[model samples]
Target chain A: MHIQVIPVEGLPIIHPGDLLTEMICERVTFEDGDILCLASSVYSKANGYIRKQDEIVASAEAVRIAQKTHEDPRFVQAILDETTDVILEDPFILSETVTGHVGVRAGVDHSNIEDGMIILLPPDPMGAAAGLQNEIARITGKEVRVIITDTCGRSFRRGQTGVAIGWSGMTAIRDFRGDHDLFGHVLEITEEAVVDEVAGFANFIMGESNNGVPAVVFRNCTRWTGHDNLHFNREEDIIRKALCKK
Target chain B: MHIQVIPVEGLPIIHPGDLLTEMICERVTFEDGDILCLASSVYSKANGYIRKQDEIVASAEAVRIAQKTHEDPRFVQAILDETTDVILEDPFILSETVTGHVGVRAGVDHSNIEDGMIILLPPDPMGAAAGLQNEIARITGKEVRVIITDTCGRSFRRGQTGVAIGWSGMTAIRDFRGDHDLFGHVLEITEEAVVDEVAGFANFIMGESNNGVPAVVFRNCTRWTGHDNLHFNREEDIIRKALCKK
Candidate 1:
């Protein structure tokens, strides 16, 4: 099946408590089985998760780590506050967020925010994704999947690719455990992370630059439906298990 | 600039010594600046990298690890032979391939091959990609980037996504270090793995099922050209540095 990614452009700068569904609805129309991938930055900004540097109080640990990493103490404190546990401390603070995503600075972003402010990941990405999906369904009278994505660096790979932080209305993992390949070999351990792949595809169009398009709609995704679960919990994720071994 | 991914269908089952460029060219025409993403399986198969189970002799270490992970000793031995270092033993064999890609089973894939046979990753993926790019350019007289991709499980993330194992004719990393974001914040650490993203996008259309479409042509990729480097060497990669802290 062929898939098409259409960028939803012309979105005004999102603000705290702003209805992202409303902004997106004004820009584009949705179709049944369409997967709308939204950048996590917009979700964080629209949810008022942006924190000013002046408002943060550096902790003793934050100060100690800040000096080592050559980072602003207040900014480091914001990252520490958002982290559940520090995974790495040398070159940068690789920490696990409360939501269980392991990344540098607890997935807290410093770029794309106003001067002296940093954008924290959406407090509840799954909830945000679910709400947005439902709202879009209500407006268009069509079922669509919503995936909230963020750009993150991966271990053993250079550069960054978009990852699904939150998703709704579609199965995040496409399990191919018992399936047979063209040569009739029983495929084992072949679960495809369809959501993350979709997020990466969307990020290619959204781009890292000033490509105002923050949201992309993927149409004709044959594997869009069929699963019961919409959200991927990091506590039970494979990536977390693999990382824990390290 | 909009991007369109068109699958090149009707290729015969590829075998060793098959001319992939001719096979692809016979089915579709090429345009300048098009990015051609080829699945690594086809390359490996065409290059006769497949190994029969009987051909492998399990070593003492392979037998020991196989007992723990419950995998076939012979298959495990093949993986061990292909690996430069074992990264993890528990759950499964996560190892670094000789090419420096850190993944399970040293990226030795068992699926899509005949029973009792497995496929190894393409040797010298960069050279293979460059050769393919040059062959296509020679035939069509049009400049096109070539990316050889493999679907592999990632650390700390569920499911599998397409990754660029080799590429030619494009800058693999889109460095945005000194660039400014929409809010005028100097963007740091925003290098996008453009090749990997393109591979992931192509894989979405390729799917894991019996979609015979192995190659995809990406058109209108405005960011497709202007850069020289195409290959990603893991020795000098950022992910290696981040993981070295452990």
Candidate 2:
């Protein structure tokens, strides 16, 4: 399938009641059966969701959080360096973020943007994904799956790959229990991490450090189901853990 | 630095004394400094490394290897299904043969070509890698790196990625201890898995099946030293035990 991950740019500071569809209408569009993977970082960027730099000032709370994670407080300042921004809480999650992804900085990022502003993941990312899916379906009159993605750290390997924090209209896992290998052995240990695989492939097109391609449409995957599957923590998480074998 | 992995095709059967440069020279050409990551399967196929199907029918040795790896006698039959044309072993490895790596069977694919022929991995993959690198350097007089790749399983993740079984002219580990994070706290968990990272990126272009692009060049990487210093192991076996923070 021809899948493309396009980043959205040029929006104003988004507010609580801002019209996201209107703001993103021009540069972004989708087709039926297309899969779009969007990074929530851009959304936070447009809305000026940042933690100010100077204000953090190595506060006792910041120092404590850093110590808790075995990180330096000055590292917190570097995270805050992208903007004069504060997250009101520590974004470096030990496991999953509020969005339930084990991503770097809890999916909160301060890189490659104006200083004094930081970006937190979209609140209720699952809802945000469903909303975007519905919005695109309504606008284009086509069924499209939306997966809101953020970077995540793998347990065994270093570095990060974009992960599906929130997704809509997709069967994120493919169970392969009764399947046989070419040799007739029952195919075990072969359940593909469909979501993570898709996410990793999408990341190449997503670009690193601000190429601005956030959403991409994937075609030719007939195996994907067209239903609301926003709960990534259950099924998807199981498949992820199984694939990781830990 | 930009790195890409390409598949190579049109390989001929190989014998012990055969020259690989001759076999691949027509189909796969490389420039100076281009790293070659050849799957062992292709190397085996070209060398005419074949095990006759019927020969193992009455052999107890065949049954022993097969039983060790939990394979059915039919596995011998399946191997015959792919190639009576060339090499065979009673059973390949004791391990599960990692779901996605290249070996006599995993990537010794026939789909890319016609049926009734099997490809085996290169003999002495590490040695071949070193030789290939030396050959490329001799012809072009430019330093090059060679990574003889095969698929292997990870302890934590289910799927496999191509890893350097044999590598030359590269320091696969980029240790980052004593390096300070922004916070100045010691960066303990920061030693990067340089080989796996490079292999992961390389697989994107190498792909699962046909796309006939062999070798990828990674340019402008300041850290990629063309020195042979890599050791391969299972991810689970390698991870240090987690310290209990009392």
Candidate 3:
């Protein structure tokens, strides 16, 4: 199967209370089986999750940690407020967000915002993705998948890659257990994170710089279906289970 | 920039001493700046790294760990032999490979091989990648990037995604730290794993099942150049540094 990533450009500066679905619809058309990858930063921006540095009142812990890491105490305080649990303390803060994503600073982003302002991850990423998926289906009358992505570093990898925080209309993990491989052996432990892979492709296209393209549409990804069997709750994520063990 | 992932089909079953580069060239054409993502299993197979279950002589440590994990002692022995350092002992065997990749079972793969036979990762992934890149350049007269990928599970993420074990002809990480975002704020911490992202996209097209497509070509990824600036030693990887801290 061939996959094509097409960036949807011409999206204006997003603001709080803007109709994100409407804005995206005006930019590009959709097709059945097309997957839309949206940057979580844009979702956070549209949902009014931006916070000013002066608005944060740093706690003693934030101040102490900031002194060591050389980061703004208020910024650290904002990250602390967004975090559900701290996974690491030194070099940089890696925390588990309220949404169950383990990443730097609870997924609190510093780029693409006004100076001294930060954007928190959307409160309900799956809900936001579902809402967008439904709106797109209603407008275009075509079934599509929506993957909400954020760029983050992994524990054993150097550079950051995009991962799916929220997804709708398709399952995140495609399990191939008991399936036959080429040699007809029952495949074991071959579950794939299809949405996350798509998110990475979108990240490559939308890019981290001032690309102005926050969304990308993937065409002809037939392996992913709109079936609910693939749908999994975030709480059931293996990463969360592994982190809990740690 | 738009990215297209086209699978190169019709490759015969690879064997030991086979010319992998020649086999690939027979199936597909190359373009300047095109990136080829190859599954590491194929590389291991062509390089004659396969070992039979009967050949493994389980050590006392392997036998003990296998009994605890309820796995075959010989298979566990193979994994132990390939491991450079054991990172995790419980739930699964997460280890640092001889090549410095930290993953499950030192990247020993069981799928796509005859029963009781396993494939070891290429001894030198970067060297193997560079060899393929040079051969492709010789054949087509086009400077193309080659990324050898393997599907592995992450610490905090569910399912598996493709990661670059070896890459040549382009930088793996794209740094945008000094670049400005849309709001003109100097972007901080925006380095991305460009080749790994391409590998993930390739994995999406090369599916884990009997897809028969081991290689995927990506066209029009202009962000990556043939310059050496993108190349960073494996020792410089942040994931390795973080794991060292633990």
Off by more than 4 A, model 3? A225-246, B225-246
> Cα deviation of B134 in candidate 1 (Å)?
2.2
Docking class of 1: acceptable
What tens-digit string does per-residue lDDT give for candidate 3 at B211-242?
Answer: 88899998887654322233333466444444
State how far residue A190 of model 1 sits from its true place (Å).
2.5
Best by lDDT: 3
DockQ for every prediction shown: 0.49, 0.09, 0.52
Better of 2 and 3 by lDDT: 3
**Tens digits of lDDT, candidate 3, A1-246:** 567878889998888999988888887778888899999999999989899899889999999999977999999999899887786666788887766677888889788887778999988898999999999988879888899998987766667888888988888887777678888987765688877788998898888879898999988887553222232334554344444444
- Mind giving the per-residue lDDT tens digits that candidate 1 earns over A25-47? 88777888888999999989988
The Cα error of candidate 1 at residue A55, in Å, is 1.5
- How much is the lDDT of residue B11 in candidate 1? 80
In model 3, pairs of residues that clash are A239-B156, B171-B230
User: Model 1 chain A — which ten-residue stretch has the worst lDDT?
Assistant: A223-232
How far in Å is the alpha carbon of A127 misplaced in model 2? 2.9
Candidate 2, residues A57-172: lDDT per residue as tens digits? 67575577687656556545444333222322333533344443444455555543455445567767678778887887677677877777665544423444555666777654
Using all chains and alpha carbons, the TM-scores for the candidates as numbered come to: 0.89, 0.52, 0.90
Candidate 1 per-residue C-alpha lDDT over B86-204 given as tens digits, one digit per residue, 9 for 90 to 100 = 76676788778766677778878777766787888887888999999889889989888898888877666667788888888887777776677888767775678878888987887
Lowest summed lDDT across 10 adjacent residues in model 3 chain A is found at: A225-234
lDDT of each: 0.79, 0.48, 0.81
Candidate 1 matches the true fold with a TM-score of 0.89
